[model samples]
Target: MKIGLLPLGRPTFDVPFAEEKLAAMLAALDATGHEIVGPRELLFDEAATRAAMAGLARAGIDQLLILQVTFTDASMAVAAAAGFDQPLSIWAVPEPRLGGRLRLNAFCGLNLASHALGLNGRAFSWLYADPGDDIAGDLKALLAGERPAGRLDAVPVATRSPDGARVAEALRGQKIARIGEHPVGFDTCAYTPEAVQALAGVSVDALALDDLFDTARTVPAEAAAEVRRAAEADVTGLDAVNQEELDRSLRLKAALETIRESGSYNAFAIRCWPETFTQYGGAVCGPTAMLGEGQVPCACEADVYGALTQLVLLEAAQAPVFLTDLVDMDAADNTGVVWHCGQAPISMRDDTAEATATVHTNRKQPLLYQFPLKPGPVTFLRISQAFGAPKMILSFGEMLRRPMAFTGTSGVVRFERPAGAVLADIIACGLEHHMALAYGDHRATLRAVAAELGLPLLEI
Candidate 1:
């Protein structure tokens, strides 16, 4: 098979050692006699990484190797990886502490890369071997389909107490408000309220963004001030945000709260997009997070089904559920990240990582929470209609300890199944990119929900 290589390097490292690692990796690839691809020099920045990835793809490589020469940026590899369809892998060299400042954080770099790639719904291979060694052999083993054993522990399992009828009885009169239309082309958001009602006994109250925005404008100044005060009290990086941006975000919170109150809605799924940024003066992630933590269950991007899923998971686990994109995964560790653009509750923030108020990554607008999620047992579930049928995908895993791989709320979860296999099921089943994430393993409850509703379940 023709193989591609991207030797990633960071600017902070002494260029020589990184260069040596690159040269050594290239030599190893040369030994394999596969059609090796990519620039002869290593990639150090976004532009170079993009160019190398495109160049290798143009050369028609069957597999791609992301060689972490020395603790490189996750964005460089992940951004490039986003466009590639070939099997992916990361090879990192270990850095030993020898009574000096660490020369390389290559392993940590790999860990972060895995988080970003896995959360994007991409599965990748990895090896922790230095260059000029048996990396080629390891690469060939991965290419030939060998997986190391890794499993999550203490995955919480709930006793199946209530049957479908009982659970549906509890949901019979519950109503959730969904504001505005789903994001464009997100057909996963297409749901008949009757379908939800028939299966789960919940109702969707469709509302308009205009109504919410209008209500927000009329909210008393004191109310908006209270929202701002509450938001600022626990967050650590409020000082970094501009005052106008901060107030704009608070106003969004006020508007949504007012709409929720007027309708007497139990939960909301909001269109937190172009309108929030273009029409309003800020992003709605912070406000959405606050609402979700408050048990209102606001689904970003106006996904009504996702919002409902959050409510269900909340009922099962009684914890806040985050709607995240499964961006990146690592085969070696059987782990990946559930990441989104800053909407996870502050309560989920890892104690070690400061809970900072930050802007959205792409739009560079204010009001998204930025922190690594605290680690423990976790569950991921997505409710979707695929192949003309409604199904709920459920999985249990351990929220492993790791630094947040990217901006926003991210949890590093190591799954019981092979990360690649889970990704394969996602594609085979045509699952949506959005997942409802809640703490603890509620697999048993989720299974009961699926069984009671006669919906299929993909246990990945």
Candidate 2:
């Protein structure tokens, strides 16, 4: 990627020193294979800044990294660049002094520049570093267009759409496991294993439920006790079939451990299928949910690609994450319903389950859930393809605080466009309707991966 570094204004101190710092920053960036535009001054005067921006735009640069805002008065130049709507990153550096009384007030100027850029409603990233730390990675990652900060930087975006078709195609060579068979004859959750292999280049392996059972049988008594305690605290009716459910759930965890121990799979999808429903006569949501949270990608749809997508996302971020279906949607208030067999990992919960989660064990049957979800802020996202394009839907807000309360929380999301319009833009390009929902904002890194894999992106 070619990055245009336009010096917004003249230096407040020595011009040569300013040039030297800019050169150092560029040199660091150059190592990463990104072409830097220059020490070119966009504005010696405010008016000149506007002219420089036009020139940069005409030159067709991918992004801009604004430098030395206090120097060379170019407020107009920054404003003009912002007008173009190119991705921007505002760099603020602390003055160099060997721990000598901390002289220059770098923050004051950076704050002013950030505010000016903010007025235009532009999204940008900020970094504070001296000559030492590796800032080029940050710059390239941003120029490539991913969130450059926080845990979200690691979340992966998988595409089965045209935008990411090549990526999905490349992914085909990879191997993954989907534990247990699809619920006997439940078709809704059925998947075409042949279609998955043909389309995604993935080799699928079906695991035995006995593996999970064996692991559960051998679990340390303490672990089983913890499971029971968690269940007792969170689920209702301990006497109403608590032991039965706990035994099954613990066994499921043990099975997951066995799968992990084998090391034959890069990722996994398990059927907490409905037989556990008829036989145990309770639910298996907690165990399956826990498996996903533990880092295995468990898909309720018995979808190989879906599990792979979740696995990719999980690899990007090491934090606890949930894999769920968009079970309900309310356009009236912009609220949606999301539920599954409740087998998501317990780590994904910031708090305890509000109520018990249940499901029939059929892998092909719709998961039945009755628990109120844990509460906290959440960022919802989906990565799927349409007409061959890879697209995403990312939004953030607090999960409903009250227990399974008020039919779930809903609100209007603020963005450059509406969800339908965004969806339209994505589908018009031919992306997939399937998406992997994550619980955090991962726009930046996901975008970067999309670009690397040659997929078009939508940022709503």
Off by over 4 Å in 2: 1-175, 181-203, 209-242, 264-266, 279-282, 344-377, 381-435, 458-460
Best by lDDT: 1
Position 401, candidate 1: lDDT? 74
Name the regions of candidate 1 deviating beyond 4 angstroms: 1-160, 163-166
> What TM-score does candidate 1 get on C-alpha atoms?
0.67
- Per-residue lDDT over 1-460 for candidate 2, one digit per residue giving the tens place of the 0 to 100 score: 6676766544334455555665666566667787677445424555565566667787787777766533222254346545666667655454432211112233333433443333333456555445456566665565676633211111344543342333444464666677677543222233556755654456788767556555666777777777666555544554544455556665555556557667556566655544455443334456555556556666653555567666545544445556554322322334433434345455444354444433232232222234445555555544443222234444444445333421211112222344334322322222222345455555455454455544444554
lDDT by residue for model 1 (359-446), tens: 8754568888888889888888877665446777787788877866666777778887888676545544546567888888777777
What's the true lDDT of residue 393 in model 2? 40
lDDT for model 2, please: 0.48
Q: Give each model's whole-structure lDDT.
A: 0.72, 0.48
Predicted structure 2, TM vs. truth: 0.47
Q: Which ten residues in a row have the lowest lDDT in candidate 2?
A: 405-414
